[model samples]
Target: MNRHRLRLVTFDAFGTLFRMREHPALTYQRIAQAHGLKVVSEPDRLKASFQDAYRKQGASNPVFGRLSQGSRPWWKSVVRNTLIGSGCPKADVDGALDPVFAELFDLYAQAAPYEVYPEVVPVLETLRTTVCEDKVPNGMGKGTKFWMGVVSNSDDRTEAILQSLGLAKYFDFVLTAYHFGSEKPGRGIFDEARLLARNCKAEECLHLGDDLERDYNGPKLIGWNSVLIRRNNDHPVPAGVATASSLKAAFADD
Candidate 1:
């Protein structure tokens, strides 16, 4: 596929652009301990509990409670459940959930626990500023402008996180599932992104993300071009999927 023809290139935020600096369970454990709560679960158990809590929250309150409770309450529930599931006594968890959640919420909003991938900045710069000859099949034309944006299944913290990492300037917009009222693996979110591109069509857009279904199949199902970003080396690229190891590699042909 000739990427030069694409007008908008959107990315999935969390696993695509940046990720946590350390295991989230460890951070949670430390925070709980610091807040004078006794967490007796092992790290692995805590991690599992956190995952369970997150999934449960998402299932019960879709899109981070955009329709009902709201993002703050939804996240507070996740944190509270995580603490309870991780073997912290319910009484202690209840006492500290609010302050612990507040600190975690603020911590994630900054760059404290996250790290942007190495190749992200250079690749974004090349896409945003590099001009190419119109006659070249794979080159982006000087007159053809491409917009960059982020589509994340997260709360309001996404944009702040990007800003803290100095990545916000590269994108035209950031759409969070909570704010947008739709999440990935559903066409509404991807369609919202296309609409945000301003007069751009589905065929003129492309999305890159770490998840196979949400990032790859979801966009493709909506008539937009998509690439599955497989940053991990443990798994082989799925058959016939447009897979890339990194953002730079995704546009290597261009």
Candidate 2:
């Protein structure tokens, strides 16, 4: 193991830092009900269907893959597909797509849907000043520098979302899949983050995220250390990979 003390810490946005105050299924259900779609008996079934559709759309969308297309249209497609896949008949889903998209877009773009974790600020504050080595000679001149960043597979509204939640200032920079045109578990997003951390090498950059594949394995493929945050304790930690119940445990002194 290359035990280089990490200097720059990058995080995933959604699960790692901010969490949705309510399950997305609830929102989807509310929207469907408002638009006169038949309510399903089990909300989980609808939620699963919507998630499947969203994931498939995300994978197949060339706009996200190419990073050259506008995010609004891409999200519109996903939301529309979610409605269609949620057992809404095609005619009904089409009828409600426009309004649902408009509302959902605004819902997530603002802060009402999300909440920052209690330990996020303190953990970031500690890591930004405590871990990592000194400055790397910027023309501006600095005595020492440690960086905190965000790398997420989110839409363009991420920065605004962070700002709304008041988590923007703690980061040196934020990179979203919309900006890179690629999602996690792929090398493009992580590689872009590497370029941003010009002062630090891969070994010196540690990434913390909630997903095992995207947050942990993805960065590891690019030579960076990764920490998996199992906030719910739903899964067991795999050997040799770092795991934490919360963000605070991630950087807490042993």
Best by lDDT: 1
**lDDT per residue, candidate 1, 1-254, as tens digits?**
56676778999998899888988878888888899999888888999999999999899989888988998898889889888998888998998888998988788789989988999999998888743335323343467667789998888778888999999999999998988988898998887887787657788889999998999998999899999888895676668899999998999987
Where in model 1 is the C-alpha error above 4 Å?
Answer: 131-142
Clashes of each: 0, 1
4-103 per-residue lDDT for model 2 (tens digits):
2555678999999989988776787787678777756377776786688677766677534345457777777776676667667888878877888788
CA lDDT, every model vs. true structure:
0.85, 0.77
TM-score of 1: 0.93
Weakest ten-residue segment in model 2 by summed lDDT: 132-141
**Clash pairs of candidate 2?**
67-181
lDDT of 2 at 146: 58
TM-score of each model, in listed order:
0.93, 0.87
Which candidate gets the maximum TM-score versus the true structure?
A: 1
Clashing pairs in 1: none
